[model samples]
Target: MANKDWKTFMIPYEQAVEELKVKLRAIRTEYRRKNDYSPIEFITGRVKEISSMLEKANKFEIPHDRLAMELEDIAGIRIMCQFVDDIETVVNILRSRQDMKILYEKDYITNVKPSGYRSYHMIIQYPVNMASGVVNIIAEIQIRTLAMNFWAVTEHSLNYKYKQSIPENIKSKLKEAAESAYQLDQTMLDIKDEIKDAQKLFEVKSAIVSSIMNDILYLMSLNKIQEASRFQSQLNKLIEYGDVSDLNQLHLLVRKEINRFR
Candidate 1:
């Protein structure tokens, strides 16, 4: 493809990446809006670089005309999770989505790679609305725990740096590090409930504090400076050394004051 042709070719893939990122992020936001833990901690996406795409096409013997059809990762989305179990949850969510059609899935987490790389890959056909018409593009979604992602990212950097010819000793060390990261993930899983509970408590407290602060600001806006100042001083002490119950009480008091003003 010529330079201009390549740019034109990438337009739909870029649109697909941006659209998928927004949709996937909305899932996380919806979960949080309901005061629930989201399986997806975060999402990131990209359209394959021109050089990388050309390299892969050459390596795989894919013809330029068939690149979009054969190159599944031309548009890639990575979903990062806090726990290993969350990968399955995210996969199920994607499978249930109506916006994209799942072509196939690769369960690398269950069947770890020889190089100790682990991730769940989903190949999906997503429809992108172009100025010309609607086109279905192949996209790859990778779901993995934070530890797995960290290890994979390091491994990818090494592979790039070594031009896919990593030294045996370094490869061995990388494998060992991958195992360590998996172990860390497993250890976290063992205490997952406790960690979740702690996080929930923190979020609840944060929400209450936010409500209290907003109400205090409302008082100041109402020209009740002395009252707002008093509440602000109390909030400062509570934020420094108070628990959730204390914050709840302060929030209730602020709400009552706001109600009186209204």
Candidate 2:
């Protein structure tokens, strides 16, 4: 393809990556807004560079005309989770979504790659409305725990550095690291409930603090300088050594002050 043609070909894939990132991030935001535990810790996406796409095409013996159909990962999204079990929750959520059609799935977590890579992969067909018309594109989604992502990223860097011919000693070390990462994930899963409870408490305290600060700001806006100053002093003390109950009490006091000013 010509240079201009290649640029044009990538437009929809770029759009697909941005749109998917926004939609997936929204899911995380929605969970936080409702004070629920979110399976997705974060999301990232990218469209394949022209040089990399060409290299892959040449390696796989794919024709330029068939690139869109054969290259499943030209546009990719990665979802990172805090625990191993959260991967399943995210996969089920994607399965139930109506916006994209799932083409198939690859469960490397269960199967275990020879290189010890672990992740859940899904290929989906997503439609993008262009000025000319709508085009359906293939995109790949990978869900994995933070440990797994770390291992994968390190492995990828080494592969690039060594030109995919890593020394056997290095390969063995990589395998051991992969197992260690998996063990860490398993341990985290065992204590998931305790971790979640702690996180919830922190979030509740944060919400109360936010409410108190907002009320103080409102008092200032209403020109109740003395009331706002009093609350601010109390808040400074609470921030240093206060529990949720203390913060809640302060929040209530600030709210009452704001109401009185009104």
Identify the runs in model 2 with alpha carbons over 4 angstroms from their true place: none
lDDT of 1 by residue, 1-262 (tens): 6899999999999999999999999999999999999998999999999999999999999999999899999999999999999998999899899999999999998899999999999999999999999989999999999999999999999999999999999999999998999999999999999999999988988888898988999999999899899999999999889999898888888888888988
Cα lDDT over the full model 1: 0.94
The TM-score obtained by model 1 is: 0.96
Q: Spell out the clash pairs found in candidate 2.
A: none
Instruction: Summarize candidate 2's per-residue lDDT along 80-174 as a digit string, tens digits.
Output: 99999999999999999999999999999999898899999999999999999999999999999999999999999999999889899999999
Which candidate has the highest lDDT of all? 2
Each model's backbone clash number = 0, 0
Q: Residue 49 error for model 1, in Å?
A: 0.6
